[model samples]
Target: MQQLTVKEINTLVNGEVVGEYTGTITGLERIDKAGVGELTFIGNLKFSKKWDTSEASVAIVYEGIKIDPGAGKAFIKVKNPDLAMAQVLEVYLPDSPHFETDIHPTAVIDESARVGKGCRIGANTYVGKGVILGEGVTLYPNVSVFDHTSIGDHTTVWSGTVIRERSEIGKHCIFHANVSIGADGFGYRPSEQGLTKIPHIGHVVIGNHVEIGANSCVDRGKFSATVLGDGCKIDNLVQIGHNSVLGRFCIMAGNSGLAGSVTLGDGVVIGGSASIKDHTTIHSGATVGAGSGVMNDVGPGKTVVGYPACDSRDMLKQWVALRKLGKS
Candidate 1:
């Protein structure tokens, strides 16, 4: 464990020290769990009462927030307590282990593949024909990159992840375990022979700083590319259908599914388990709440919720009415 004095932590977070107590903080924990020699944060007013009851030796609090003088803990007041705590965490957390810049013997790389200098290819990984991997790219054990795929610098494809043919991944992206990129789309046509599968000839394009979580799937387009814009974050078990385009900085939570051809503008937030119908558009700054089923276009900056999603306020009123009726 690393220990930092009150003055050292205050300088790190640019916070102002309040109170007379002096001690070194050895660890960071939640308000309810922090004990002696630990630092905790009070970010919400609801948790303010817990400050006095907590046994923590030090606390981080937002500017202008009042703390009981009797709490006995030293306080560091900052503009944003949550962000300050994160800065402190970075100082104490251990860095991830680095892998040697060498390809494992069990890995198979096609003769035509171009691997940049300093790349690390792990055991059982396969780099297919004509693939281009940029500098410092790391492919963990059991990872697969199919023909002609291009992955940019500093990207990491974790164990069991697969990047299919012609997929383009940008720099600093992370594809977690079991992620499937450029998979065939769920397209079919009725014919005399039965349901004929529509071949997906296109691929997936992920922009810089995007992160696709474990078990997530991003399908290839029918003719064009399925795109994830810069800084987008996709949570675990997400499904982005064929030709769907997510704009910059969009966030899709766990279990959220976007149907084929869906379009989301910049900064759109899709809550956990939300489902968007095919061809629908969610404009910039819109938010779709958890478990919502979107069927139509959501205007910019709108908030929608509930099954067959509507305005959030309307949904809340409906819930209130239902509860009153039940009471009667």
Candidate 2:
């Protein structure tokens, strides 16, 4: 673990020292779990009472917050203690893995594939014909890049991931283990010959800084490309159907799904296990709460919750009314 002096930490978080104490912070932990040589933060007022009992040598708190004088712990006061804690955690976390610029012996790259300088293709990975990988790209074990696919510079595709044909992935993107990009959309036509699959002739386009979590699936469009805008984050087991477009900085939590042709505006947040119906539009800054089922468009900055997704306040009112009626 890395260690930083209390003074150095104060500098990192742009914080001011409140008491005279010089100690090294070796780790970051919750207030209840933090020990000596660790740094903890009191982001909520409820946690303030535990400060004196905490074993942490250094504590980050909001400016003007009252502290127990007898605590005897070093204090760093910041404008936003929670944000400061996040920044401090980033400084303490381990660096990402690095690989040599050599393709593994078991890896196969088609003659027509174009791989740029400083790339690392790991064991059993396959690069199909006409694939283009930019400089410093890393494809871990068992990754598959289908024909005509293009991956931009410094992208990392982890093990068991598949990038289907004709997909375009932008720079600095991360596709975690078992992620499937450009997969066939779930479309079918009912006919005499049984339900015939609607062949997905399109691809997937992922913008820069996108990070897709493990086991997520982004289906290819029926005619055009399913688009993921810059800085969009997709959590594990999420499903993005064909022709879905996610705007910049949108966040989809674990197990959330967007049906075909859905559109999400910038900074939209979808909570865990939420489901959006096909062709619905969710405007910028909107939020869908956990387990919600959205069947219509959501306006900008609105927060919706519950099964058929209504405004969060409306949902809460309904729940309260039901509880009162039941008691009566």
Candidate 3:
């Protein structure tokens, strides 16, 4: 078990300790559940007010919040308590599996593939012809890199992930288990033969520091690449359609989906279960609330909610009216 003194923890987060105490914190837990020898955090004023109820020996709190730490307890005040807690958690993060910087005997690498120095190709993994893997890339067991794909340095592809032909992935990106990249887009047209499938010739382009959760799918484009910009984070079970372009630092929560050609500007946040229609453009910093079905463009920094999503304020007014009608 890892333990740190209150003074040591305060130094780690550059926090000012209030109500001096010299107790050791063994672990971290939720504020409500934290007990003696445990550390907790109060991110907001409400949580700060509730500090008295928490049995934690030490807590990280926002700098300006005034809260009384009971006898023998201490509060470490930092600029942002939530971020401070994350820093502390990073210290406690367990070690991940170590790749041996060598290819497994069961792995298959084509003669035309180019693998960089210090790469690790796991058991039963396949590196197709003309694939270029940069230095320090790690492909876990059962991963497939199709022909003509290029993955940048230090990228890690977990088990069961498939990167189709011509896909381009940048450095330091992480693809969780079972993620599917570059599958053909869902495009069909009515024809004499009932329906004709539109062949997808394009691929996927993922930028640096991007993380895609397990079971998420990024479909191939019709003519151009489906793009995920730098630092984008996608949650589990999400679907990104063909030719969709996500700007830098965009975040899509679990179960959210985008139809074909949807464009999201930088810092856009799509809540869990939200759905965006085809050809819609959401500008920078826009937020789509959970369960919203977006049908039109959303301006920068705006928040929209409800089915057939509208401005949050307008949706709130409509909801109030509907509630009054129900009462009447």
Clash count per candidate:
0, 0, 0
Question: For each candidate, what TM-score against the reference?
Answer: 0.92, 0.93, 0.93
- The residue-by-residue lDDT of candidate 1 on 1-328, one tens digit each, is 6789989999999999887557788899898999898988888788888877788888888887776535456888899998999999998897554655479899999999999988999999999999999999999989999999999999999999999999999999999999999999999999999999999998999999999999999999999999999999999999999999999999999999999999999999999999999999999999999999999999999999999999999999999999999999
**Once superposed on the true structure, which residue ranges of model 2 sit more than 4 Å away at CA?**
69-72, 98-101
Best by lDDT: 3
63-97: candidate 3 lDDT, tens digit per residue: 89776787998889999898899989988776767
RMSD for each model, in Å, please? Answer: 2.0, 1.9, 1.9
TM-score of 3: 0.93
Error of 2 at 253 (Å): 0.7
lDDT of 2 at 301: 100
Q: Rate the local accuracy (lDDT) of all candidates.
A: 0.93, 0.93, 0.94
Model 1 poorest ten-residue lDDT run = 64-73
